[model samples]
Target: MSRIGVVTFPGSLDDRDALRAIRLSGAEPVALWHDDADLHGVDAVVLPGGFSYGDYLRCGAIARFSPAMLSIVDAANAGLPVLGICNGFQILCEAHLLPGALTRNEHLHFRNRDQWLRVEQTDTAWTSAYQPGEEILIPVKNGEGCYVADPATLEMLETTGRVVFRYLRGNPNGSQHDIAGVRNAAGNVVGLMPHPEHAVEALTGPSTDGLGIFTAVLAHLGTAVPAASRDRR
Candidate 1:
């Protein structure tokens, strides 16, 4: 089975949820420490969300220098699949792996609620199972969820089709263009604000729309191409 590494920082609250999601998607979940400095031969990594380093200075600024992050950055650049959720998204920005920084909610308060997201682009390692324009509902919670980037970066992101997810109903946290998620230029690294792990089971009461992310990651690792018959290659 593909081994998925979930990084546990000092304040990560969603590490276990990420592990369960990986298992549900038929992958072996590996718990990696924040200071390990190694990926433990895992096929992929998931930076689960929470108040890393107590969200000091900035959401992920302090955690960016964690020893384990160095390994993750190297592997991610070499095409290892990486997914950053919420504060993980912030870390991606802080580490310069992906563009944009998450800022305080426009409402100026920590907000938590089920969010509606539109799949803006599906040609990514973590969203291949979704069709362009697919809409999903996942829970989002955070104080700084708004995504901001310079004009040039924003234009480049838009032109490259790197924007993966967007807010649908409410622009919860005021993410730019209602942007809920984005990917690196190479598509190997992705970051999103919503917590997909929290929505994987229907017993929790909401639709299981978030499961597509984990399924999509598995699809990325597998040799199977999505909609294989539609491929002309």
Candidate 2:
């Protein structure tokens, strides 16, 4: 089975939830601490959302130097699948693995709600279960969820189809081009500003829109895709 590593930083909020999601998706969830120097040979890594270092020094800035991140960077560069959600996205940008930055919401308030998103592109390891143009709703919560970048980077993302998920109905955080997620050039690393871990089960309502992401990883591990969303395109 694919052992997915969920990295836990000092103030991580969703490590458990991420682990549970991995298990529900039929993969073994491995606990990885920020201070650890090893990845335990996990198949994939998930940087769960949270206010690491209490969001001090600007979101993921302080957490960037955490020991675990060093190995993560090396592993990611070697083509290990890595998914960074919300604050995790911030860390990925600070780590220079992904382009662009996540800034404070235009509203200047922490937004928490179920959001509609379109699978703009799905060629990456984390989003392969989704098809082009598939629309889904997952919960988004963060004060710094606004995605931004220089014109050149934005242009590159637009032209190369690296923008993976996009806000559908409303641009809650006023992100550039309504981008909810993006992938690295090789498509092995993905970072997004929403919490897919919160929408995996039916009890969470708003549909099981986020399960495809977890299942996508599971499918890569030799598991079959769930029938409920088989044709999610």
Candidate 3:
């Protein structure tokens, strides 16, 4: 089976949820520690959401320097798939894995809601299962969910088709251009402010839309190599 790792930082609250989602997606969920430099030979990595390091210094500023993140930086540069959700998204930005910064919401309140997102780019490794322009409902909860970037960076993201997910209906956090998620230039790394792991099961989530994210990665791995040889990588 394909092994996908979920990194648990000191304050990570959704690592288990991500693991469950991965298992439900037909992949083995490998538990990874924030302080461990080794990836445990997992095919991909997920940085689950929470106020890492007590949200001290900055939301993800401290966690970005964790030993695990350092190794992830190298693996991601070598084309390993990585996903970051909510607070995980902040860590990706702080680690320079993705562009832009997530700032406080315009309303300055902790907003939690079932958010509707449009899949603007599906060519990415973590989004291939989704169709272009497909809409999915995922839960979003955060204080610093507003995404910001300079004009050039914003233009670059928009022009290159790197903006992966966009908020529909009303803007939840006043994010620039309604951008809820973005991917790196190589399309192997993605960071979003929504908690997709929370929306994987219909019994609890708004819809089963979030399962697509996990399944997409599995499919990517399947095509990348045969199942028996997958873990060897």
* Top model number, lDDT: 3
Residue runs of model 2 more than 4 Å from their true location after superposition: 223-233
lDDT of 2 by residue, 86-138 (tens): 99999999999999999999999999999999998888888878878988889
Q: Rank the candidates by lDDT, best first.
A: 3, 2, 1
Please give the TM-score that candidate 1 achieves against the real structure. 0.94
* Candidate 1 overall lDDT versus native: 0.87
| Model 3 regions lying over 4 Å from their true place | 223-233
Score every model by TM-score: 0.94, 0.95, 0.95
Work out candidate 1's RMSD over C-alphas.
3.9
Please give, for residues 1-233, the per-residue lDDT of candidate 3 as tens digits: 88999999999999999999888788899999999999999999999999899999888999999999999999999999999999889999999999999999999999999999999999988998788999999999999999999999999999999999999998999999999999999999999999889987768899878888888898889734334322211
Stretches of model 1 off by over 4 angstroms after superposition: 223-233
Candidates 1 and 2 compared by TM-score, better number: 2
Q: What's the CA RMSD for each of the models? A: 3.9, 1.8, 4.2
Q: Compose the digit string of candidate 1's lDDT tens values, residues 62-102.
A: 88899999889999999999999999999999999999899
Model 3 residue 52 CA deviation (Å) reads 0.4
